[model samples]
Target chain A: MSEVDVVRSSSMADEHVIEQAPQSGTGELDALAAALRDGQPSAVEGIYDEYGGLVYTIALRFLDSPERAEELVQEVFLAMWERRASFDPMRGTLKSWLCTMVRSRALDMLRADRRRPRPAYSLDSADGDRPAMEIPDPSRASDPAAVVETRAVLSALDILPDDQRETIELMYLAGLSHSELSGVLGIPLGTVKGRVRLAFAKLRQHLGIHLEVES
Target chain B: MTTCAEWEEEYLESLAAGSGPSLEVLAHMESCPQCHLLLQKDRQIHDALKEGVRVVPPPAALKSRVLSSIQTSPSAPQLHVMTEGSSPARSSRQLHRGSILIARLAAAAVILLASGISAVNLARSSSVTNAAVALQLPGEPVTYGIVQVHPASGIAYLANASLPAPTPIEGHASEYELWYIPSGGVPIPKGALVEGPDGQWHGAVRYPVQGSGLIAITVEPAPGTMKPTSLPIAAARV
Candidate 1:
């Protein structure tokens, strides 16, 4: 069999928290990658069965459109199937790696279109009044764990200082870099970094989950 | 470049930048556990946040399209396995010795460094400890660590511990495996505890925990066994 992990994360309302837990183990990842590399039957399908939904969800969120997300899903899987030899579970979980690639690719698409994804709800702007993010998938809110984890992250972001909140929203959701964020926000690079540091510090203390949102 | 205290600002700067640790910083982290923990924490936090935004489930057609698309795509060239009839992951493992070596060296260095600090602390405490909470260590507990997990998230951690390897091996990094004892279910081996710079073990389980369960720890050699070879030295009933 491939690999699966036994990592379960709950809200900080209980014990500590885990971010994204991979569904498979290192040996499992290695096996999956190897099988895909050798073009074994159902190997690609097996991967899709595991993480297809996750990949599509991330693509949709970043690309802000279903058509693009669909296209991205196919593109990403094909690339992984072809580049299977390069995947090393030792680097990180297949989940983490896929998430990173999908986000980066979606951002690349956004940049090519010269557009940016609008947040569902603006966490920072003065009015702080904006339309919420629309996820056409009503079934998404069905999973209790996913709901809790999503709420926890949003809640953490909600509590950050407006500046800090905005800093991460743009950096994370938009995949903007420190320098890019500085230019867009018209703030100094040091100031941008300060907000990121303070925001993550709060995230670690408040939710026990966090990281720098970089492109 | 210099002292950890000196590296602190540079570390955070790079961390926030998402540029990853530089060679100098990594070289420094080779000796510092705090920096190492910070790095893992940073990545986990980022991963969690990224995961948060991706809660939407995919449509059925997406999976169908992906499945069918592969039918038309070119297949990977079939190559003979170097060793006859080895497993898939094992075959790949044999193919990329360089990558495996680099990863092993990095992990070993981190765990070795972590054992010096976090493991030492656990050895001294032997009691439940951590910002979250510690798992109970049975059988007189040598260098047992704390465990903190979210109920449904399958997010478990062996916060701090350093114990001698059960194997007769010498001077090698010690790896303790975590197990999910689902109430009365069969013991499932999760993964080996990889020590962060802070000397705590960090990793995830494959799926979510449904009801009551117990997470325990056992020391197993590499490649892994179907079951736990030794009784648990660390355990926490949830």
Candidate 2:
């Protein structure tokens, strides 16, 4: 069904509630887009809630500076707010869009910084002498209920062949495109797509889950 | 044309979007029980993930900082209704015209270069055997470093004698890729390498910048390839 049809057919109450809720995936993205276009503040909040971590994680990974990461996060949200009108649902989902923006900005910062010589610290050098901070295994659980679910997802991810997992992480977490993935992974584009496909299939089989696509 | 796997992946991608699949994928999905069942399960997993992915509240100061930055920054081009104001529209048109004039001037210069006898001199002067000649990063402070250029072979070597090994991600490996952005072309992929086991890495890439003038290094996933998927960790103009 067309987006207009979905928006119109859904009851007003349902639409309003969906607008307020943090979007999980693309449906929430569409709803968020609609809300932002309508100038709804709640939609902005929903977007932040849904993608703030992803953005923060990416920024932190690249910047290695928490302060810079936080700064980039704020910049991303501002960019999102300003560019809301330009977001076209046809091109890609909001998550992908947000990620693209975050990555571009981060890259710009990185390139800019390369000219300046900054003091460097290597985490690897800290080695045994340093106190070991509890490394949060994103795969490990902290709580029973939510942790179990997270673990299941991680387990499913773990079962994927190495190539597939690596590709998925680079594409989803690291924001690499198919061509970029091929470049980073040193594999053919066809191989990248194949690995992604197999990865998705394995995730589905292991988790017994299917992703829904909005027509 | 869609294989079951493609259809399934597309369907899942759509679900991630919080919607149903494309008409083509969905049609196949409707007729195919395996795919249909897969779709149902995908929805459930997505719903479960919604709850599992906790939304960390943004820092309170971020809003104020963002708003302040926007306010302090130069105003972007403002769209004015024909009835609201004439000044903005006039200014906008003038800006557009100015840009066009500048572009025309640039094009004319290029044409002149192509047609003029000076073009030979230009070509000769521009021809640098080592396109990988190390140049400082534009607008950045220059640090003491050595950029080795093998102009004849089109190879550039970047060595940071005092550079430190990049810190690894908590749970993942980290590596670097080199990029050579040609003077007027797309950035070309060089190769990927990590700092030596002792916190230093020195490497060379087959330079694609035959006539180009820049070299850059970007942190990337291990097993690097031709193009960069991530941002440059360091860059210098060659």
Quality class of the docking in candidate 2, CAPRI style: incorrect
* Model 2 C-alpha lDDT versus the unseen true structure: 0.48
Residue lDDT tens for model 2, B130-157:
1121222224432322333434334444
- Write one digit per residue (lDDT tens) for candidate 2, span A1-215: 10101011111011000112333775766788888766554576676666766666555545544445556776787677677778876765676677777767877888876832111111221234421111224455454444454446544654666456545654644344665556545678667767766766676667653232211
TM-score of chain A of 1: 0.50
TM-score of each: 0.36, 0.36
| CAPRI class of candidate 1 | incorrect
RMSD, candidate 1, Å: 22.5
Q: Write the per-residue lDDT of candidate 1 for residues B37-132, one digit (tens) a residue.
A: 566555555655655543344544345445433432344342211232233323333335423333343233234324342221211222222323
TM-scores of the first chain across all predictions?
0.50, 0.52
